[model samples]
Target: LGLALDKPLVAVETLAALAYNLYDTEGLVCPIMDARRRQVYTGIYRFAGHRLETVSGQEAIGMDELLGKLEGLDGPVTFLGDGVPIFRRQIEETFCQPFSFAPPHLGRQRAGAVGALGMQYYKEGKIQTAAEHRPEYLRVSQAERERAERERRAQEGQG
Candidate 1:
């Protein structure tokens, strides 16, 4: 598989968004994956002149913050991904910009779409060996944090 990674935000929805953007659609392609704690992993993209242009890149941010960034953008934003339903109501209420959720067939993560994107990246010379591959855990797991806290408390004779 070929993919580039320079940031901790692993966009699970990128491939989905790319698939959805295959048509002659305009405005923003906002793909968001739930990150728990009211945050989501998201990115904004647009097909300007029929070429993909990243608006905000990928980010792990609260829904509110994400909305703030979209406040000034032009309308007709099409949002997709698993996180869409989680904040659907909030999205509807908060943004004055015209928006719509991608239908069931295109919104969720699909292996075919992801594989297609991987192939595209491979063609673009973004290949990397399995040895060079690494997982993108944007934040430490709660268990790890709790263990660290336990060790700290033990050292302080509080555990």
Candidate 2:
């Protein structure tokens, strides 16, 4: 409708949608999404009565910091997203409990789940203008960060 109406199209964050599903379907709390390069797009959520309530929204987090947050929680922590592959080894080494990985089908992002979750959020007064929506990349890529660091060092040497 946004396209036909010539209105701005708003999209919810993928990580947020995943978090919502964990809360709604699995009765889990504080689902997190790895956004690669040791960073994550995370949120704190819980099921309240008949509906899900978002205690926190999108946030940029470091892998170690996220693990610490999970350690503080009482239940099993699960991870899903393309970024998981990047940090799988490190995660397994760092955590003490048995970690779970979603299968190929459920691990990747899916539009169907996103749309359904978005609808639920829309009805709960969570909808926003397209201008307010943005993909949660969490952090600058490692290449970009390294390039900036190199430039900084070059300038430092010249001056």
Candidate 3:
């Protein structure tokens, strides 16, 4: 609605905002959004005092791969976001390091966190014109994949 309201926009990375949900906690923070096909949109973060620092940038990756990356990091991890519920069992079964899931109240996406992060970004001169703002989708949509597959099959038929 920034465009409609003629207001400058601040783009808060979803994973970063989700990690901010645990700004008060110690150790590593992981925010995992279910990206389907057994993959998640995730990032590793830690709070250096009150400032959140990125241990790993957000990306679309399989749960196994993410777990593997976490194994190399020091200290316990606190996981949050939609992927927690879906991957909890697997994480418990496979992850070797100590970890805990965020309680239900703080597990999912929250607008408050996003707004707070957005405000921080604005203070840091990260604001952009509404026309310059764009949503970041970490991977191609299912529809796009399906369309590509269909084109490939059509080319095969022609050959």
Candidate 4:
């Protein structure tokens, strides 16, 4: 007899994970984190009655585009992660409303925060078992994307 699989797998991108965590714990609005090298992990959250839910599709985004979208929202925002220095200038230039950064100690990935948020989501029907979870990497690596584009162009030329 074949081995039986027991659980479903859910591949959540890093940003979505963070956003969900934040929303589930702190009830913050539109939390965003930079993943490095001009990429962002971002999403929006709002409080409804007793809980927070994400408005974003839980997707990773490029810096410029994410900034543009955030700019359009016109609200107070906070940023976290190691990418702060890399995109400081752009973020400052783009975000018109008040913005702030989490301290170095609080920034970056924290299992405690994740667990706290996860517990909230768990209570609200978002929990998944160990066998059900996977990491969500929003964007392809630069090399992979470039290669795919090259291949597409090559195929176009051939056609």
Residue pairs clashing in model 1 are none
Given candidate 3, what's the lDDT at residue 40? 97
TM-score of each: 0.74, 0.64, 0.89, 0.65
Candidate 1 vs. true structure, TM-score: 0.74
Candidate 4 per-residue lDDT, tens place, 1-159, comes to: 111455532333345344443442333454456666666667655555545555566567788887677666645666665566667788787767677765655555667656655566656576465555655566678899999999999999999
| Residue 97 in model 3: lDDT | 98
lDDT of 2 by residue, 40-98 (tens): 67765556664655655668888787777666665555666665677778778997754
- List pairs with backbone clashes in candidate 3: none
A best-first ranking of the candidates according to their lDDT comes to 3, 1, 2, 4
lDDT of each: 0.71, 0.64, 0.91, 0.60
lDDT comparison, 3 vs 4, better candidate: 3
> What does the lDDT come to for candidate 4?
0.60
Candidate ranking under TM-score, highest first, comes to 3, 1, 4, 2
- lDDT, candidate 1, 1-159, per-residue tens: 333434222233453344344444688888878899999888887776644557877778899999888877885888887788899999998888888888856777666656655554556566655556666665678899999999998999953
RMSD of each: 5.4, 4.1, 1.7, 4.5
* Runs of candidate 4 exceeding 4 Å displacement: 1-13, 16-37, 46-50, 127-135, 146-159
Q: State which candidate has the highest TM-score.
A: 3
Off by over 4 Å in 3: 4-6, 156-159
